[model samples]
Target: MNVVILSRQQAVERVGYSLGLDGSGLNGELSPALVGQALRRATSILAPCARYELERSVRQTLQPLGSPGDVVGPMVQDVLESLIVYRDLLEMRSTADEVWASAEVTIRPAAPSFVKREDGSIAVLGTAGDVITPIPEDLPARLVHRGALRLLVPTSAEPLAPRLQEFGLVELSEKAWLRLPRVEPAGNYVEEWHRRLREAPIGNRPEGLLICKPTRRGTLYRDRWNPAEVGETGLFVARRPQRFGANLWCLVDLQPNSTARIVDLFSTGDTLRSCDVAWQIQMALDARAGLAQAFRCRPNGDRSTIDFFSPIPSWAERRLFLVGRRQAGTGCLYSYEMATTAADGERRFLRESLWLVEQN
Candidate 1:
């Protein structure tokens, strides 16, 4: 896919300019500087000023480019740039003032004659297909780490070293294992955990994000989460994506952002059984994917201004990014994973939702 940014004058109206990249928009009120910084960051990441092998390196560069008043203006720019790899598929992850979790869910495609409703919603065509429903109005727009699982860390010389070895755990030389005190119900528990971590007294120690998994194998429920599934009883930790697409379709992001990470996982459905990182990312966003439709990415503005030659609203002034694949026809099967974090250390995980099986 190709992307073109606006010129200097358009950049001024579209994104403006900033000196204190970090501090640009820190005031109680929003300002053009802040807006510009965001736009610039979005442009750099979505469209990308540069691409690098390691995302961490990109973050290092961006930490200094924060908007005015933000001492880290230039650095932030670098970080955003590092995360630009996912710009093509609209799979950029972001962790700014708010966290937005989204996915593209696909059902079997129908006949060509099927039509979308006036409001831009697609419907099932036949009386038999009538059982199919439109996208839910209250569809979940975000994914939160509702809870975590904490397990006891054996304390001894060799301790659980043998178990770690058996499980292929990669031991971090000096980090101490903090026992997972207990498991709580899903509602509001994550916020409580984070709050407690923030208030931990001096000398108190904790390591890594508190991960929650299944406690038992059979039919699983949220409240009765089993740790063995999501966490490592050994030293090695398993990473998973929050959503996914099949080989035929590419995953796309509705909103683009800087510093996003994409990955791939196993499995064809929304269930969390098999997912992982360390795979190729899709670099094209299929305009026909559910995500594009959900984000209203298609041109919907007045016909006179349907500027296909111009940048779309999603990429006009801010950082625009995407990640996914491109293949001929449909009926392809691939998997992907992604995550995003902000300058403030906020993080968002994109777990694979389902496989995208294109209809012929």
Candidate 2:
């Protein structure tokens, strides 16, 4: 069956009715003015994504009248389409004192959409879908790690790694595993980590350590580390520990420098699994830092990933950093590493980099 796509106008009208706009205005039909008002309202909400803002606005606006009828489904679809049309016009404003303070920013596509020119700066595609702005050569380092561009792309689309490689922009990949250092006992750093862990707010606390063992049941390997296996065993250990299993043992050691080291045995997992580990650690760090709408990347590279992360207001900080800046902005760069043992007992190391970009 062929699918039907709604035009931008139809989408706006459908979304209006869903939000209880009544479809009556100066023109007798859903006026562009009313649709514009609703769009502005959704923009004000500034959800993690445009779709989220539409759904939330619909619910909040209609809540007083009670649940919406069957129109809710098509209305959501229409609102989403409208959001895409206005994406370029939507500005993400930051309250940060340093750069981007009170400045409105727009979300620009990255990778295949943006490319590096010979001058070392990146060429950004204009609204007309052509390269117009050339990001300074020095700006890539600042932007790659600091500038927030949604890295997640659809699997059905082309893989970005190859395109990035053409421009020497593939900073982290499967090969990054070669440069990671071996994990060792944290020693005195453990005490300092314990103190920080205690001082951290209860909501940000990480769960107890997880231990996993790998076993070979023919050619396939299965992990035997289940939370249930921990049983009544205490997570906190004061001294050096021996192997927890015959083939694989995983240990998380916290250091005084606000870093964690995860030691694992049997590290033959694929790149996808390693990415999952990196994403998990990034989420934990974002939560601890009180950043809202943290971007979570799937282990398998696919189109399912969203391209942006947003920070919500917390109790202490009323304003959020909306742009990428070196000194004080919402953009942050983080790296995580893990050491794994091979079936032959040879240790292999892996590392992954994460960028959390603030969005409207």
Instruction: Judging by TM-score against the true structure, name the best candidate.
Output: 2
Each prediction's TM-score versus the true structure: 0.19, 0.22
Which of the numbered candidates is closest to the native, going by highest lDDT?
Answer: 2
| Reference-based lDDT, residue 180, model 1 | 14
- In Å, residue 121's CA in model 1 sits off its true spot by 19
Off by over 4 Å in 1: 1-16, 19-58, 65-89, 92-213, 216-237, 240-360
Model 2, position 232, has a per-residue lDDT of 33
For all candidates, the clash counts are: 80, 3
Residues 190-254 of candidate 2 have per-residue lDDT tens digits of 34334544554332112444332222211111132333132332223211233331122233444
Cα RMSDs of all predictions?
26.4, 18.4
lDDT of each: 0.23, 0.30
What digit string (tens of lDDT, one per residue) describes model 1 on residues 60-95?
444333334554434433333222221111122222
TM-score of 1: 0.19
